[model samples]
Target: MKLSSFLQYLDALGLLDLIVKLKLRNSILLVIMCHEIGKNVYYEEGIPTKLFEAELRYLLKLRFTFLPLCEALEIIEEEPERPHRIAVLTFDDAYKGVYENALPIMLKHGMRGTIYPVAGFVERSVAHWAVQIGFILRNMKTPVKIKLESLDTSLYINDEYDKRIALKTLLNMLPRMDVDEINSVIQCLTQFLDRELLHEIQELHERTMMNKEQLKEMAELGFEIGGHGYWHVGLTNISRERVRQEIESSLNFVNAFMSSSVCKLRTFAYPYGLYDDNVIGVLKELGFHAAVTMKPIVNKANNLKLYEIGRLSPYRFGLMTLSSFKVQLMRVYT
Candidate 1:
């Protein structure tokens, strides 16, 4: 059985909760990585607001203490005599869904987490390139035929299956290219798809990212407004100097907007959960206190690496379920 199904089976037999009680101890921290937080049809990983609330409620019932990213790092670094069963929520890419949908729910539950915005996206009011791709795939007409000259591949989308395959193929190929080439591919797609790329961008802009005002409001509300890079490109794929520019520009934008109270602990989530020695070095040089990756392992406080912190995401688990979520949470104690 798949893990989620297995967890469901355990739930059916009344063993899941028992297992949770037995295994979920208060000894480690669980950092959750998320993106959009509403019914983002174009964004698959985007969790609906109701489901997010359910997950939060489930975590609370299991007695996990929600910690801000900064406080969680402090506890791990200090190695306190007693550690709370900690969970930190980190939203990547500053989707407006977070401010419009996720924040109210989080506020109602007395929880605070971290938000990472792409400085360029927020400033330009544009969706991430991935979101732009999603918009094209979802809105393009049937029987679509397009050529990706960058990848030397052509897509023929006649039905939903073909559309999905085309999307997966493009998504897989796009990240491997540098930002300039990716832009070229997008421009090519806009032309071949015969769609008004600018109009689609405008449509997605409101759904994709928060503006200056919303970001400021979240910062004032005590959220750790962190950086996801200036352009949301993979830092590891760029030149070291370009990486420095991205990090410095991102930090400058975040630092300028975040309150001193929130800026006291500067944290970052890698744009694609990617980094290397050079990336880490740049982060340290730029004074980032902690950085999180897409790794799905729970953090062991005693052996934590501040700059190389790991995080978990529901997207990797196939499906979102309370039972599956509980099993994922059990990683903290295991």
Candidate 2:
């Protein structure tokens, strides 16, 4: 999945739509070359995180399904001014591998995208207690003291760069603690790991979050359901009435059982997309309409913003050409 991704090198630089469908540009360069094949078969050096998580689930199953049938059968079958149509295949903590591998590659290329999902880790495998206390004190062998209130580290991380310096020194002190010091450091590292290493550290984050019947089959497939706040935490470190009680308690948990979903559910992708300026004025007084940021830049309906929304972090494909996939999508949007 490294067809030199800068958004698949800006969709293979639409060079006259790959010179008018050279077989849909060799079938999206062989779907970004088997989407990074077996990417070092489940992460060797974690093969650049399994080649940018298999080319962002092969560019969200090639943008919600065959980039609109390769633009209605081969790039712009009808282009009357919608040229800013750059791919926006998103998926933040909207995980469960976006309903297992971006919805079966968006059913298999009938394509459509958008998913923000952190509504507090959905039907719960509940993560982000500082990446489950830095993978349980980086595979604790013992000697773990972490006190806080002044700092008294007992630290005993034996190797692998002292387990990435004890998981970046408790993620720079778990965002300055206080959720009862992050539930007493996730109950003192789940009382020194076990429950089979906390279910293999929640299956080492293969990204999970989609449950109530697969978010009701991604809200019956039209797919615009948004929101990410309910506990992936960080509304500029809490309060403005806890960021409207974490975005109206995650829009009442994605509207507890749809109940006729989409009610002016303007968009949101902030949890870990991080926010500020009073968290974009509490996502425009809680009626969002548009918000996304991991800040790479491309969304354009009159350049909307509650926060400077721009994205495209999926990269690391390594081959399948046109100058190495536009040098990894110009290194994620240049």
Candidate 3:
């Protein structure tokens, strides 16, 4: 079996937790990354609000210190010898579910996290193309053939399993394609679906992202509202000028609402966890203090990189189970 798979097997047998605790040590930080938070079938991969609270309680039971992303990074940089289990809770996409559902549980725990909002998404009331695609596939009611000229491929989706495969196939191609190409694929797929469903995109977006007022409230509440790019596109694939514009636009949007807040930390999370050295340079030029990536690893004090900080997702293989979660912590923390 693969190493992670093997570890998960042990975790299922309730054997991994003891091993993790035995080898657990101080001086490491776990930067946990999350996305949508609600019980929406269309967003099947999203962590449910109840499960999120359970995860928080699990970490608290383990005596993990939850802090904002900036504070956690500062500690990793300046206090390498601190004896505690440190964690930074972060959410990407600024989904409405976060404000509607996750906020109450977090408030109850006295916890704070970083909120990475896609500026264009919040400003224009448009869902990211990927999110729209997900909604389309999840809500598919009949068999359909999706043709992608860009990829020179076609997928015949009939059942839930087939839909899952097609969704995975398209998402896998997103990182390699530019913004236009990704949008093109989405358009083609949506056209294949019913026209009535096309109108749902706007409704989906409105339900998917936080409105300006909600975002302002989050900032005022002291959550680190960080940038996730204006277009939510991968910066590494775009021109340097475009990259600068994307990052700058996002920062400006965040700063506009955060003007009244005391939290002024400038941070970013790479869209789709994709970035290169050039992207990092643009972020630095744009005055961002640090950026987080989707890489799953424990961040030790000595090895923390400001621009390439690694983050772990709560969902494993697009689903979150407490057993799998414990195993993930074990694999990284030990």
Candidate 4:
């Protein structure tokens, strides 16, 4: 067996718990990152509701204290003891599933999480381009040939797997293309699918993102709302001026919908977890408390930078079994 599979087997057999118990006594802060939480339709970006609940229950059983990102930062700084294993739950892309499917589960456990919304998608009630691309490709009835003139690449999506591969390729290429160019590619692909069929797919795909009222309601429920950029564009690929606009606009948009007593737009999560020194400087200038990245590791308090805080994705936790999650927790500290 491969090394990773062997390690997973060890985790599944519950052997990794002994390592965690023996080696990791010191307090460590873990920030868990998730994109969506609902029934997995595309199976590309979400953890099913049952699996998510299981993970939360497992974490609570371990006595890991869940905190808001801002509060977690304060505790990590002020509390020298770090008495408990600290965890901060954050959901990216602000999908409606988070508020609908995930919120009730979190509330059952008396837990709260941070959500970062793509301002444009939230306001317009549309999926992010990346999501739209996936939905279109996944729901396509037959093989379709399309050429991305901007990237000078052509693809034929023949089946579900081909659709997945095409979606991945488009996602990697979109961040590097101009906004208009990206839209052109999407428009070109849409032409190959029937309009009514696309509409049918959208209706069946009930995982649309949260609307403004839902966002406001979530803020009232003690969930922190953060910015995920205006257009969900990669900051590093865009011009610095565009980066400033994206940051300022998204924060302002979310702040307008939030009550200061419940939540404020104080944090930012990089779109696609892509950033640069200029992006960090922009966030600092905008007076953000902290920013999160998609990095997969537990953060150490002593040498953490507010602007570039790393987060661990659920896939790193091994979503199939609780033992893998435990192993991931230990693996981070070890």
Best by the TM-score measure: 1
Error of 4 at 267 (Å): 1.2
Worst lDDT run of 10 residues, candidate 3, spans 325-334
Ranking by lDDT: 3, 1, 4, 2
Clashes of 2: 14
For each candidate, the alpha-carbon lDDT, in order, equals: 0.79, 0.51, 0.79, 0.76
In angstroms, the error of model 1 at 245 is 1.0
Off by over 4 Å in 1: 1-6, 194-198, 332-334
- RMSD to the hidden true structure, all candidates: 2.3, 17.1, 3.2, 2.8
Ranked by TM-score, the better of candidates 1 and 4 is 1
TM-score of 1: 0.91
What digit string (tens of lDDT, one per residue) describes model 3 on residues 1-334? 7655775687777686776576456566788888788746353457877778888998888788888787676666666666647878898888778899888888888888889988988888888677788888887776888778899998999899998898888777776777678778877877776788778887977777788888788777777888999888878778889899999999898778667455556889999898988999888887899999888877775566888888877856544676667756754632
Candidate 3 residues lying further than 4 Å off, grouped into runs, are: 1-15, 41-43, 75-81, 138-143, 315-319
For model 2, the superposed segments whose C-alpha errors exceed 4 Å read: 1-89, 99-101, 105-107, 112-127, 130-184, 192-199, 202-235, 238-269, 272-274, 278-300, 306-334
Quote each prediction's TM-score: 0.91, 0.28, 0.87, 0.89
Per-residue lDDT tens digits of candidate 1, residues 167-263? 7887777546777888888787676555555575667777667888888888778788887888878788889999999999999997886554443
